[model samples]
Target: MNFKHLSTSVIGLLVLSACQQPVVHIYHEGLSDTQRFQLKQQLEQQQINYEFTELATPDKYNTPHLLYFPGDVTEAYIQNVERIVKGLGFDRFDSQVFSHTGHYYTKGNLGLYFPSAYSERVLPELLFAHNCGDQDFQIHIKTNGQWTAMNSPIDLKGLDLKWEFYETFFKLRRYFDDGTFQQQVYQIKQHQVRTLQGYKPAVTYEVLGHRDYSFSLFNCDLQAIFAD
Candidate 1:
């Protein structure tokens, strides 16, 4: 091999590799000193190129930390950064992408919001499904003296229930061929619980209502509930 040509090829590969590397800018406020040290160590361990700038004032975004990346970055880079920050005891962080044109946009952003250390307790959520097979049914939940209709694979988070101690009454209406609905009601108590992770379904309640139809509840992981 010609030595001159080999040297030129090595230089070209190095340039390409450097261009592909992602540079991350971390803006943080309200982070303890130990947390900051751990974050830096994690970033260095991952060989991630990063810069830390302490915000003189509280972050306008109103979050503990924010990770800003270039618009051309990839998902792998984003995940690595998220894993590092979350490992540092920050359960929640927001991320955004900045264009080369100096404009910020939310397109293709993760927009993840997890429960942080600030929250005293995680409110239990309800997730339920029916064993009626192909039969279509309507569900409504009444809490604090108000009733609202709901859909199956029911999640109480979307129902906007008050974050306090209360009893939720579920109404299940299963339609039959006779143009009538077989209705049943279920009562479940709700409260908050302290958890290492975020809020999850407290318990799986198997409600045996009508002879032909019944529904059961189960705990769902955060990923399953938040999957796009």
Candidate 2:
């Protein structure tokens, strides 16, 4: 082994690594100044765990990059911009974390996703779904600053309703073609209880609605906030 040659090669590799920058590229030209600042703050504070270069040009490049998406674009935007990239046979990371996880469950928009919860008189609830022994979804409400998690709330089993395409405030579902039809047992006391990690304090930011369904932050944690 030539020690001098190996030392020179190590320095060369360090130089090459230092020169390459991974950028968070913003493609949406319509972003307002406030929105841009908010996105940057969110990424820096909670989302990104590494340093990055912020790029904003439309030029083609050979550097490694990921597209910074605001998670509010239409499906057509993917077909137009992203599809073109794929059509040219390029693969890249997209930062729209809520692409399919969930969306805002607005008030009065309750008709969109909470018809069943309302019908059972259990509209004000937090839903949690996970697979312990088969997929299980539980409902809870904050009562007197404590969670009324069990004790005969609107519990669902044999969940077989399926919706896929795009999620609107009207359809509050993530996966399709599963056995997810609405089956609820209201006002019955439940003996089984468990805790979900992501919905609690310090695990995720305590904002309500669509963000509760985000893939990155919530990730099968609290599926939806059904109340105002």
**Residue 138 error for model 2, in Å?**
3.4
> Which regions of candidate 2 fall more than 4 Å away from where they truly are?
1-22, 26-37, 41-151, 165-167, 170-228
Per-residue lDDT tens digits for candidate 2, residues 144-220, read 32333343322323333222222112222323366443211112111112234221111111222332322222222
lDDT by candidate, in order shown: 0.43, 0.31
- Among all candidates shown, the one with the greatest lDDT: 1
Model 1 CA lDDT for position 48: 75
Error of 2 at 215 (Å): 27
Best by TM-score: 1
